[model samples]
Target: MSVLLPPYAEALGVVAERDDNGRLVLAMDFAAHVRGRPGFLHGGAIAGLLELAAIATVQDRLGSDDRPRFKPITVTTDFMRGGRDKRTYAAAVISRLGSRLANVESFAWQESEDTPIAAARLNFLLARATGSPNR
Candidate 1:
């Protein structure tokens, strides 16, 4: 399926592709726009990528027909290490998807999955699409 990312995501050069496990992965290339403090990535950019990954994951799970409108309730992020100037990747795992809410966890890494640079836990309020089947 084709994923239509938001304008900001496009502007940031974020792309969605499947991993070896057939799961969606969001990737961003390091550039001046996302650079910070010489060679590191800006914190805001990393957080944005994480948020987008979470949203994309939820959308993928819901499918186009049953897709719901999402409103972010809260996002708690932890920075483990500085993001270096390189290709950064992020992916989200849906912890829970209820009738009206979703809990998602996302992580961003540069070199390897074992070494994540940042992580975020996000809670979102989901509104069922009009005329859609009830969950």
Candidate 2:
């Protein structure tokens, strides 16, 4: 499906790219626009980026003409370290796929391969392909 990102996400410098395994990779470069405490990235901004990445992964897997509207059922985020002024990557994995709901877990990391900056667990209620809300 043709998914057009929101203007706000675009303006924040979030870029959605695909990896070799077809996983959706959402990335953003640190700038003054998203600073939380001086040089650190904002928590909300990270959460937003993670959520966007998770939603996009679900969409990419669901296929064309299928809109997956995710309501943040519950998200527990752990800030492993301060997100520095560098490009950050967010990756999502579908943990459980059901007919009504899907559970996803995502991780955020800086360029360093040795450490993860943050991680999050997202529970999303997946609507039917016809756009029917889960009951």
Among these predicted structures, which one has the highest TM-score? 1
What are the runs in model 2 whose C-alpha is more than 4 Å off? 1-3, 128-135
* lDDT of residue 129 for candidate 2: 53
Tens digit per residue, CA lDDT, model 2, 1-135? 555566767877888887797667889999988789988999988887887777887777887766666667889888899999899999888998765677888888897636888888889877665756665
Candidate 1: regions farther than 4 A off: 129-135
- Candidate 2 clashes between residue pairs 3 or more apart in a chain or in different chains: none
TM-score of candidate 1 against the unseen true structure? 0.93
Question: In terms of lDDT, which candidate is strongest?
Answer: 1
Clashes of each: 0, 0
Residues 1-135 of candidate 1: C-alpha lDDT, one tens digit per residue = 678699989988999989999899999999999887899999999999999999999999988877777789999999999999799999999999987889999999989999999999999988776644543
TM-scores vs. true structure, each candidate: 0.93, 0.87
Question: What is the TM-score of candidate 2?
Answer: 0.87
Please report, as a residue range, the 10-residue window in candidate 2 with the lowest summed lDDT.
126-135
Error (Å) of candidate 1 at residue 48 is 0.3
Query: Under the 3 Å rule for N, CA and C atoms, how many clashes does model 1 have?
Result: 0
Error of 2 at 121 (Å): 0.4
